[model samples]
Target: MMSEALRIAETFPGYSREDWAAMVEKALKGQPISRLTTKTVDGTEISPIFERAVGKAPLAMRPQDTTWAVCQRMDHPDAAKANDQVLNDLMNGVNMISIAFAGSAAARGFGLAAEKDVLAKALNEVLMDLIAFRLEAGAAGDAAAKAFSDVVADKGADAASVKVSFGLDPIGCFASTGALPADWAATLVSTIKDLKAKGFKGPFITVDARPYHDAGATDAQELGAVLATIVAYWRALEDAGFEASEALGMIDVVLCVEADQFASLAKMRAMRHLWALLLESAGVDFLPLTIHAESSWAMMTRLDPYVNILRETTACFAAGVGGADSVCIVPHTIALGLPTSHDRRISRNLQTMLLEESNLYRVTDPAAGSGYVESLTEETGSIAWALFQQVEKAGGAVEALKKGLLVDAIAKSNEVRGKLVATRRAALTGASAFPNIDEKDVEVEAVAPIALAVPAAGESCTPLKAMRVSEPYEALRAAAKAAGNPPIFFANMGRIADFTARATWTKNFFEAGGIRSLSDKGYNEAAEAVADFKASGASIAAIVGPDGLYEEKGADFAKALKEAGAKMVYIAGRPKDIMEALSAAGVDSFAFESCDVLAELIKIHDVLGIAPVAKAEA
Candidate 1:
């Protein structure tokens, strides 16, 4: 058999893979150093994750052959415009539709215009056979309750296999509006009972945990919130004289899967396992759970809005691999304003591409059975399960919510996450670093959060409204342009072994940090390099070559560069007398093999305050 085939055979050998892993670890660990190490918020020791970390879980589920529905969100100021958007998105591979209210007027407009009966009739009439519906009960006030039930019943009349999830919870409502009706729980219970009695097999009771996640809850905490919320519903149903199985059957949930692909993937898988465990503890057998995964709103950014596509893609991929029944990719332009019809179509298309072209939906539980993925699944599931149990023992999710324990735990997790961001352990692309200057401030008709009659309802939308500060583009651009022809110089003393790899790596490292390099083929002679540096007015020079060159020509090269008027020179490897020679030559800084070049570039950027600019037109 081929070597590739042999490697596969080796992985599934008769003995435990742990033995091989141990041997590999021993071989890999040739030396140990006292470097700073960090741990996850849950106190789990953070280690480099690879394919090897996955072990012994279900590798992939075969029946996940069908792609999930890509839902396009509609929240326009006008009903006809929103309806037109819904039609366009549905035609363009959007199998699901989520309607959100941008304002109280918007919700009222949708309610009054699409009038409970007319709206339900139109929704029932218009939604194509393949499309499902999600109603985000905005601040429609008294009209919300009737509109919700009417719409669900309308979908039911056609016997069309469409999903209808009404984000109807008194606590969620209270959180948004700070006005909870006295009959909030009673209303919800009645709605769930009504849906089930009407033979609606779709997830009738959606536990919206996105609020908790957007509020900065950890994955474990988010899962805990979901479970606790489910438990709250379970207790409420039981108090309403429902059986365990009935309550379990009525429960559905949505979770916020972030851009941290691996963690989010693990979180999704763990969610299923956690739900299974919760049901088992409740003396209920397996009941199918439907989970709708949304991209993390907290991680969305206004600057470099294009990067949001990358974020949403990974979030969608993670959700898909983690087995979410449905995944919603929010538009990149959503942060600026009410999303355009085009934006919604593109967002929906991302998932369509993943499923249809990328073949992501061909396998269920795709990350299963890997040593690392399985380990993460087990670990995350176990931790979340424990938290769920704690929440249940505290008299369920509602009690925890009422007493503020759930919020308190989430606050603690957010604090840790905040510290991680502050300390640079967790870097937010485009926002924390690599900010965009030419970017425009996004202005959109804001989606005023539906006020829930509860505490923390609007907390999820706070980050959305916060203004982001970035340096003015023209000023920064002018500064960068003024700095002009910022130096391109490389340091090499003489012919050296492995010159190719060293140069390639150095060039790559520099380019990755958004700096120009002065490397090219056939520039081998030190004199020629020095001449080019002089001709180009190079201010900084980097020496990347073998130690032999440093030994043979270090002193002479330093002396020559100094006489040639090079301001800063960096030597790749340590010379026999680098400090002495550089100090003698009056060089600004000397970097050895142990130096971190990226860190060095950051330092340079700080000192110069020189932003990057497009090369000036000749």
Candidate 2:
């Protein structure tokens, strides 16, 4: 009553940053503070503790409304079917529709046909004045824009009331497909003029950075690409006789929201900060940055498609809390095939639950003033701004791509990420860790194959390839499944306590590659284990035991399994001192913590006659 704030302030002494650090250090029991630091993929070191930001400008103003638009991607090839899906989505909860056009690089070979008839059919019952529409037409964006305009006119909707985005990103197309269908400058001029003539008020040109993000770019690199592309568009628009402010108003930013929730949230906030700073530098009055956040395709997996639900949920939450103007949650079964009605509904409802049930939309800039998030936002923004300057120095985004500078940088980051995935340093649930070998194939609608646009002659550049982190491991699983999920027998040496841990580890390890393990109970003798292994008809047998037991009997057990018809013998634990003896006695390899899981699985596949399918060179 004297005032709650005054009471709390009187009860506790204010703690300084150093004081907090001292307490954390003391709690660590003399461990270095650096031990608590985490290095992000972008090479930014994030400390565990952060003091309140001092003399730092807020990233962006809080949204006037707490809620964000629940956007859904509508990419079915059949326009009628797409329209049905759209109506269903809107009726359920979705307020925004992203129309992905066939042959758009962002569509990854799946989308509605880019025709006026198809556009009209897809938007047949959609209320243009109420719901938003975003077009992703890639190289054909200009054509698609005209078609959409025709549909709106035919629908008798007021053009000014319709919330639509042309989704024109020429640099994104070039980076994705290694070429542009038309000259970049010519395409931009024509598209901008057409939209301006139509009197469209929505952001017509989209500066999409998804190509970079899906290509395995770090947060800094993705943000840098967006900044560079935004600047490039501004310069182009000015050259095409548009005012700087008008050009800025015509553009929007689209970023990928991935499974790393905190990182995703930080990235969204950082991009807003970067854009505000860019506009401030240009002396343009602040215009609200329109951002469209979509769940990352690179994080989806075909092996365990259901896990993608959790991934997309976290992504949607991050986008909403991070202050995205709109958020699109990709269907969980997207990687398997064209998403079925059920798949789309589930994804859409998850967003609804987050907004309504969870009430995530009740706060604007939810992460604002949080020490860790603020620190991450600042660090991420600083790195991104520096990279943006590098692009400017190398001539803007187009020149950077033409010179292979952007592609090379992204490839380097991809190399690091690829290594992390292969070694299991980065865990992909149900793919790289705790995989379910008996997982049923996800059912999806049977749709026509995606049609990709062919690049025209004399229009070529280095393309940044998009890849999923689970592909390599998924390939290994597919190979094993193709081989009828061959069994790997585990020869448990000694009592249950002596071998259970290693046996479980070995079973999960093989199952991660889709190879089922028939694990036998404790075997006191090598002959008994050998008999069980032979009876199980397993081509591969793993010797599982504690280090002490391995030192004593691992060699004899490996030799026995080899004699009992095991094509290869694997040791579950890594006892370096006894490795030589076990190998000499017929142990083929050892699976242990920190080992290269992908490489080891491939080797096992080779020994079991499971030939992996050839992968195309990126």
Per-residue accuracy of model 1 over 1-618 as CA lDDT, tens digit each: 477856876787574555645655666683322122346676555444344543355533224477776876666635566667777776688777776643322132222232465454335346434567766654442345456556655555543254566555554443334344556567667776665665555455677766666666678877887887777777777898989887777667778776789889888888888877777876777877888888876677655667888989999999888888788887776655566566666688889888888988887786776655666677777777777788778776655655566667777776676556543356546544454433455444444433222222322321211112221222233353356525447765445454666766565444323345675533445576678778765667776666566655655666667667776666655565556765575445554333444356555544555765652110
Per-prediction TM-score to the true structure, in the order listed: 0.67, 0.93
Estimate, for each residue in 334-357, the C-alpha lDDT of model 2 and write its tens digit: 787788999999999999999899
Model 2 C-alpha RMSD to native: 2.9
Clashes of 2: 0
Return the top candidate by TM-score: 2
**Model 2's TM-score against the true structure:** 0.93
Q: lDDT of each prediction vs. the true structure?
A: 0.61, 0.85
- Give me the candidate number with maximum lDDT: 2
